[model samples]
Target: MDVSFLGGPHPQRGVGVVAPFDFALDRELWRWVPAEVSLHLTRTPFVPVEVSLDLARLVSEHETLGDAVRALNAVAPEVVAYACTSGSFVGGVAGEKAMREAMTRAGALPSLTTSGALLDALTELGARRIALVTPYTVSVTQSLEEYLAEAGITVTDRAFMGLTRHIWKVPYRDVADMARRAARGHADALFIS
Candidate 1:
């Protein structure tokens, strides 16, 4: 990307990823996606703002997320991704759309959330049966499974990585292997945390 476009870049192309804490994308996504835009990281700290799987619960609590969204919009990111997949889907398409609408209405900016992107990606990939691997407890992870199922795709199998899912410099290949092991089943593809 042109350096001038992204907040007067230092080295990498500047893309602002405005999200709540714990909203990290898998390396696999970047492997296939466009690389012209790089991300500038900013977020609500985890200690202050907990990640909520329930979309309504999330929205109800964090009314400031709208202001956060507007602040990110002011940064003029090439793509402003909301970055919470399960929470958005827990609200369903309408919920995701409503979140985007609130952001745009507050700032007149276009945005995409992980939940919308997942469904879109699934549609693009033509996946029917899928394996779900999340970094949530069983109850929340099952909510995600149900969320996906409500979208018409079946969750053939599932595994949770507990509430705190992290990698202390573990290699991507190792993570992939763990994901594969965790979600071993006769299914289409797997969603790894």
Candidate 2:
């Protein structure tokens, strides 16, 4: 009956995550995290707008990010990650950098955005050309393409769903089909946004 030998819970390091209000991939995010680390996630304020360039801009405003980062600071995460793909890329590279800087200024922690991480991964893999798949309208998808291009990566092919809302509900079969369509051309990688 003596279970005291188990001791208290292990100390956990945390990564603060600022996700869009509609984000539904918390489990997916946790899958990549190590057992010893924890994710402290916060969402941007909900807005009436559906998923679009305007919505992306709204959710990722500097003031919004700063507020989210400050809230996460209470948990003392070692680093912060802005987890919206569209919001991060809609502003392009410069915007991504500014978002990180703003989060750092608010929380005094290292910060990164999803678009920045994507670029870093591409560079690490030496993937100069890629095929893109997104559940965004043409305009939003084009913004992502422009963002990638600014990072010197070419989009060799692409497929989009033209979706405005509930992107998390997209069926895996449909996504697979879209990926298949996008990957038909020569590409160093396939990026699903």
Q: Tell me, by TM-score, which candidate is best.
A: 2
Cα-based TM-score, every candidate: 0.73, 0.96
lDDT of each prediction vs. the true structure? 0.62, 0.94
Tens digits of lDDT, candidate 2, 79-179:
99999999999888999999999999999989999999999999999999999999999999999999999999999999999999989899899999999
Regions of candidate 2 where Cα sits further than 4 Å from its true position: 1-6
Candidate 1: segments with Cα more than 4 A from true spot: 1-14, 22-35, 45-56, 59-62, 165-174
Cα deviation in Å at residue 183, candidate 1?
A: 4.4
Query: How displaced is residue 5 in candidate 2, in Å?
Result: 3.5
How well is each residue in 1-193 modelled by candidate 1, as lDDT tens digits?
A: 4467657744544454545555555454456555565655556445433344543245422354566666766566655666555656666667777776765665555667777778888888988888876656666677677768778989887765555444224466765765777667777777764
Estimate candidate 1's alpha-carbon lDDT, on a 0 to 1 scale. 0.62
lDDT of 2 at 95: 93
Best by lDDT: 2
